[model samples]
Target chain A: MANLTTKLGRLQMKNPVMTASGTFGYGTEYSDFMDLSRIGGIIVKGTTLRERQGNQYPRMAETASGMLNAVGLQNKGVNYFIEHIYPTIKDLDTNVIVNVSGSEIDDYVKTAEIINELDKIPGIELNISCPNVKEGGMAFGVSCAAAAKVVSAVRKVYDKELIVKLSPNVTDIAEIAKAVEDAGADSISLINTLLGMAINSKTRKPMLSTITGGLSGPAVKPIALRMVWQVTHAVKVPVVGLGGIMNATDAIEFMLAGATAIQVGTANFIDPAISEKIVEGINDYLDTNNFSSVTEIIGALEI
Target chain B: MKKFILDLQITHKVQLNKQNVLLKLTSKDLLPEILPGQFAEIRVDKSPTTFLRRPISINFVDIAQNELWLLVQIVGEGTKRMAEMNPGDLLNAIIPLGNTFTIPTDKNAKVVLIGGGVGVAPLYMFGEKLNRMGYKCVFLLGARSQSDLLLLNEFEKIGEVYTTTEDGSHGEKGYVTQHSLLYNPDFNYIYTCGPTPMMKAVASYAAKNEIFCEVSLENMMGCGIGACLCCVTDTTEGNLCVCTEGPVFNINKLKWQI
Candidate 1:
């Protein structure tokens, strides 16, 4: 078998198939469908300093080959995660990463500090790109200055690998990636979700309660690949790519586009056992192409 | 209950009406134990416009035939594609999802199952289970017209069926709540599933009469599991996922205005 080990700064993955945040719950949710250890990493739901009730009833809308969600980081705060959720996931064999979000800088720093104490968690993916929340989600991510400020504040208290997740809603994602890297981000993961909306012609109303939400699925693949390529060339830090990664081919496309690692998002909703299949698919591709290691394809784009 | 993602081959397809189709599916292995109010997320393949799996309620399970039935309504692209499937087509589905309805302990307790449109699907399975358990079942089904009413013969085999159609072509000339049988509903328990407004009216009537009631909610969902917190209902406890916490919930737990 071809070697599938992947490295992003201090964080090492057995393979490059990580589940995007908000899609995969705590690793326990999918324990019945597939082996959780088969995944490279599991980024738990976005946790905040305070509990959030999230948006109203209709928070989801299905579009052509994609879906929109305005589930504004509905979580029970980080403390509940440490007390209730941590113990269950701490013993999982794969890398367990927490995706942290906040309304203010202090909230991000405090949540990161608390998670930093957890022995099992290898890193934190700072989510500055959640489009659903009203306060500091995509607000901080759209601006390079705000993105750097939040990353730098969390860097002071967080000692582990700090992976800043970049939002695609901005004009120049590469500039934001560079700013976060300069502010002490160990790695950068990109193309969180593109902001989009869906409308019902008959009802003459928006499909989602929030009118607009973050779009993820196969529809956003091309945009994610373009952003990953641009940011990888502009920044020095390793990049984790995602957005409509449904299979191993999609995962390899991200690698060829210069993403050091890749994540699978909306496809998880369609097929629960997708990540494991993707891991196998990647291995099959490596063996067929006679590549010795999975890392050989990173930034191997001919053009 | 344990959930399974199985490739079930369609054994039979019956077009109940222009808007509805009854698909009977079976696997090589014995079908898993499924409760009355639970649902299945069926994957719609080859449909370009459909992205997510469609969540359809379990209409019935014929144990002797080792089959599971799904009564689908052609409301959108996903379901329209489901209606077009042939007998030999393989449909992948995640089965036994969500919570089940409460089965009363007292066999003599007066129970009423109310449904409207394709909302009557799950209640058919529920009524059958209640009848097999030695409880007399009363079903109050509603539709836009006589033709829109589905599974009348099947429901009649298991319970005393009453219906209402807007066009006065069925039993009553008005909505299910307007049926004369509800004038003095001496029911001990009521279970309903239909349009939101219809279910709300049922909840209101049940609350006023101090009858224990439960209603099934059909909310837009992302993932049928607890992961995608998309299909949430405002309840007394907080925003709970309708997929995991319930497709069925007690009226008292709901935050309905009634």
Candidate 2:
């Protein structure tokens, strides 16, 4: 078998098949379908400083080859995670990263500091790109200045590996990536979900309770690939790519586009066992191509 | 319960009507112990417009024959595709997802199962369970018309079946709540599944009469697990996932207007 190990700054993965935030619950949810240890990493749901009830009902709309969601970070706050969720996932063999979000800079810093104390958690994916929430979320992600400010603030208190997750709603994602990298982000993961909307012609109303929601799935793959390619060239920090990554081929495409590691997002909803299947698919691809290590393909695109 | 994702082969397909189709699926191994009111997330392959797996309720589980039945209503692209499957086709599904309805201990307790349209799907299995346990079952089914009503013969075999059609072509000339049978006294418990408005009306009736009631919600879902958090319903406890916490819930816990 070809070596499948990959790293994003200090965060090393057995394979590059990490699950995107909001898709995979605490690693325990899928323990029945596949071995949780088989995954490279599991980014738990977005945890904010305060409890959030999230958006109203009818929060998801299925589009062609994609789906839209306005589930605005509905979590029981970080304390709930530490007290109730942490103990269960702490012993998992794979990397259990927390996806942290906030309405203010202090919220991000405080939450990150708490997660930094957890021995099992090696990294935090700073979520500045959740489009569903009313405050903070995508607000800090759209502007390079705001993105850098949040990352730098969290950097002061968070001692673990800091991976800033970038939003695709902005005009120049590469500029935002560079700003976060300069602000002390150990790594950058991109293309969080594209802002889009769906409408019901008959009802003359929007499909989702929130008129607009974040779009993810195969439909956003091309845009995600282009952004990953652009940001990888512009930033110095390692990049984790994700957008419509359905299978191993999609994961390989992200690696080729200069992503140090890749994440599988919306596809997890379709197939619970997808992440492990991708780990196997990546190994199969490496063996067939005669590549010695999975890292050899990072940014190996001829063009 | 431990959930299993299995490739169940289609043993039979019966088109009940233009809008509804009943599919019987079985696997080589014995099917998992599925409770009434639970559902399956069936993967819709080859359908370009359909992205997520369709959450279809478990209509019936014929244990002796090792068959799991799914009564599908062709409402959209995903279900329309499910209706086109032939016998011998392989359908992948995540079975036994969500909480089951409460089976009361008192066999003599008055129980009524109310359903409307394909909402009657889950009640069939539930009624069967109640009947097998020596509880007399009364089913009050509703449809738009006589032809719109489904599984009348099958439901009749297990319970005292009563129905209402909007066009007055069935037992009653109005909604299920408008039927004269609901006027009967001493209905200790009621279980219903149907459209939101219909369930609300049933909840209202049950609430007004001070009877214990439960209703099944058919909310738009993603990932048929707690992970997606898309199918959350407002309840007394707060926003809870309908998929994991319940496809079935006690009326008292729900924050319905009634």
Best by DockQ: 2
lDDT of 2 by residue, B82-184 (tens): 9999999999999989999999878899899999999999999999999999999999999999988999999999999999999999899999999999987
Native contacts recovered by model 1: 0.85
What's model 2's lDDT at A74? 95
What lDDT does model 1 reach? 0.94
Candidate 1 off by > 4 Å: none
List clash counts for every candidate, in order. Answer: 0, 0
* Candidate 1 lDDT over residue span B1-258, tens digit each: 888899999999999999999999999999999999999998999454898999999999999999999999999989999999999999999998999999997999999999999999999999999999999999999999999999999999999999999999989999999999899979999999999999999999999999999999999889999999999999998899999999999999999897
Clashing residue pairs, candidate 2? none
Scoring only the A-chain of each prediction against the true A-chain gives TM-scores of: 0.99, 0.99
Tens-digit lDDT string for candidate 2 (A5-90):
88889988899889999999886878889999998999999999989999999999999999999999999999999999999999
Specify the CAPRI tier of model 2.
Answer: high
All-Cα superposition RMSD per candidate = 0.8, 0.8
Candidate 2, lDDT over the whole model: 0.94
TM-scores, each model vs. reference: 0.99, 0.99
Taking the candidates in order, what DockQ does each have? 0.87, 0.91
